[model samples]
Target: MDGTMSGVGIDIRDDGLARVTLRRGDAGNAIDLTTARGLLDAATACERSGVRAVLLSGEGRSFCVGGDLREFARFEGEALEQHLLAVTGALHEALRVFARLDAPMVAAVQGAVAGAGIGLAAAADVTLAADDASFTAAYTGIGYSPDAGVSWFLPRLAGPKRALDLLLTNRRIPASEAVEIGLVSRTVAAGLLADEAARTAEVLRDGPAGAFGATRRLVAAGLTADLGPHLDREARALAAAARGEEGREGVAAFLGKRPPAFRSAASPF
Candidate 1:
């Protein structure tokens, strides 16, 4: 694996899986400006590395506790405003990059997921929470607004009404309820998080990357765009994929009754 460590740790393995870890365990992986920059850097690196899948997780008791209150407490007035602007800029860029990337993203979450942590989980294509995991939109309690795409993804995932409930009330929802409400893809035992995430990542990494990427973009666009334009977009994407090497291999594999070799040297993603 090719690895780098900072506030965020990125390890791009041989199988083209990028493992992104939030490294601030002692601090519940809270995002300070520096950590936000690290996140952006890690995401940029993932795009540049041509990885086929991404696995995001935090290193400790919680996935993340959101913005570092201690860090925020240090600034005042204009200084505070500028600091927050810079922090959110970096954080948003990272999430945008991951969302637009060809590689699919999966998150393994445990412990507390609060504030911007909810954004992270929402942003992932699939999120697997440990049974002990809990989610809370802690922004209102702290007299802050949502950031890190929480306002965007949450409304779509849980519907505007339910999303408002979480955003306004700051009520804590455990993994089971999160799943019931579609806030998370599913829940697993805490001990199974790593293995399940890894397995899911591997499956995505070995799949038809181009098709997966196109489908992801389509889904995201469908949420906002009208049907006619969306259909045009889908048609173009399908035609493009059908002309690609991966598409040819998928068809050939089916005819041959064999698994598709999406990772072959000449494969198109």
Candidate 2:
């Protein structure tokens, strides 16, 4: 169940709960060019594995510190812009894959969640933070605009005003206040963060697969789609879920007074 895939480490349970951990803890789990590609590779593997849920975390004191500034410093002008483009391209691909997957993402965040790290954490369908976990939009402080989908995810998550406040001020917020501001779903004791995240992932694994995925899609589309097309999308999604195996099993199980065994479904993406 445990192996290294690209620069990321994966542990897949028989029940289809996959753990995707950032492996460069020694370096604060910074996202270098290699790590960006590694993330895409790991996400692709997860899709192929038919994972029902994913628990994302890092191996050390920090969840992720964002891009590797040291690596960025190695370039200048056009070289820097090109390097950034390459890094964001890979990172965006990974994020897109995860967003399109049926499996729900649960991020177990601790320590620092800064810059692009903030985007990574925000992208999760649900995020569980350690009591000591902290969040900051470090992009502006470093004279950079947002990347890694932070600009897209933050406003929807923390509201436009609050999102801009974080982006412009680069103020660090503790986990407790993070929950208040809708930055994280919940906070747990630092020692129990792993267990809590796994429990959340297991809950998601047991959920009705197509229905859950459809719900995520509906919510996301509601943010941008016009009311008419959004409603059409929802209708189609619901009908598709109703025609799926999990939907039938769910209905039958309810009628029979039994637990539904909702198996993992391959992501359409």
Candidate 3:
């Protein structure tokens, strides 16, 4: 859509917010070689976008349909293995970058978010949704297993039983139910989704850039490793950064009973 023949479409508005939209609505935002590469490229672009926040969403009815069946139809044995390797490897690398972004990521899900889309959303720091949003594991029902890091994200977010049940049954979970199940952070009206997402990003943009990144790192570390060390590291970083320019401004503003302005761009990791 960006005048390029890629499966995914990426556009960054001047406000420093990048939106990665799955443009292949005809086949849903199914994962293909082009899409996979496009995904990595988009993540790289976002990392350099100078945007304080990023949102991953879709352009049409469905968020993403899953892997492209058309691409897989040509697979035999070794060729299939090669294709899978390339796609998954590229995606995982991009996920690591996306996860380490300094500013928060809020995945805005609307309509259908299936399979790999779940994996993508789970990688985000936060997820917001519309009531019509629905989720499906959509792997086993098709005689295939999970890919695009779905296995890792699903079990961690939804728990083992929940993950297994969804993958096995391919049941649909609506946005409201998803929040209740701890799958999404908030559910908003479909019409206000864009405005809401922008507002949230703006709020984070006003905060200290270093503090935001440090806090995100702490949460991620706590999720995967020991909580004590994570807190300890966070405390140390906060103390050190508090002496910097941004932190000095924050302190002065608080003492003056005013708001402190901050730059939007920050480090990726």
Candidate 4:
């Protein structure tokens, strides 16, 4: 599948890799209502297609600059409130779908990543930012609170205190600092960002899909699960994986001193 939905582009390859790109480069990929709906549509397609991996990126200098204030400025009072609600509702639902996916997501961000952009980047299992990238929590600066899971993800990724500092102060941090604070996975040269992101997504696509899904669920559950119960969950997951076809292939490959063919051995979701 290859098409553009509003300002979002969806390209799903035969190799089970989905590329979702923010296509409104001239508008800084801002999340207008149409863009929000487009994102949800793209995410839904990926889930339905059972894509093994997703790569999210932007087409221009900046990944995204957050909500389109210019569009919001057109409304007032109840109209503005209604408009924002629709925007956030769709955007949040898109994030929820992406989070629940068995496939992993990789975000390649460059230039400005602010507000909702930060949330989108943080939502990824792995986020690769260009060395020239900059991040900021622009919500407070605009007299608006956060949407797009920014409030939820930041506290977990960067710690509560750091998250608050960024949110309250609206400070812009470089990609290096973002990595240091755990806001991003790593920073690559601007020119290498696309290749690195594609490489990472391809690696994930070629991995054991079932095992990867289990691992993703485990980590997300572990974040809030109690130690004892989490261990039990882990045990159950491990046993199931060990009894599956991928497990047998992996063991056989090890004994034969050969790389495992996880993609071929794994079952469909």
| lDDT (Cα) of model 3 | 0.77
Q: Identify the runs in model 2 with alpha carbons over 4 angstroms from their true place.
A: 264-269
lDDT of 2 by residue, 165-264 (tens): 9999999999998898777999999999999899999999888767877898898889888999988998898888878888788888899999887763
- Alpha carbon deviation, residue 209, candidate 2 (Å): 1.8
Clash-forming residue pairs, model 4? none
What is the total number of backbone clashes in candidate 3? 0
TM-score of each: 0.97, 0.93, 0.90, 0.98
Residue pairs that clash (backbone atoms under 3 angstroms), model 2: none
Model 3 clash pairs?
Answer: none
RMSD (Cα, Å) for all candidates, in order, is: 1.4, 2.2, 2.7, 1.2
Q: Residue 161 CA error for candidate 1 (Å)?
A: 0.9
Order of models, best lDDT first: 4, 1, 2, 3
Q: How accurate locally, in lDDT, is each candidate?
A: 0.91, 0.88, 0.77, 0.94
lDDT of 3 by residue, 1-269 (tens): 13332766776766566677778877777888888888888888878765677777777777787777788888979999899888888777788878777767877778888888888877777788887889998888888899877887777778889888888999998898788767788998999887887787667756677777778887767777777777788789889778877788878889999888666223332
Segments in model 1 whose C-alpha atoms lie over 4 Å from true places? 265-269
Enumerate clash totals for all models, in the order shown.
0, 0, 0, 0
lDDT of 1 by residue, 1-269 (tens): 45554598988877788999999999999999888998898899888887899999999999998999999999999999999999999999999999988899999999999988989998999999999999999999989999999998888988999999999999999999999888799999999999999999889999988888899999988999999999999999989888898888989999999999988823234
Q: Which prediction has more favorable lDDT, 1 or 3?
A: 1
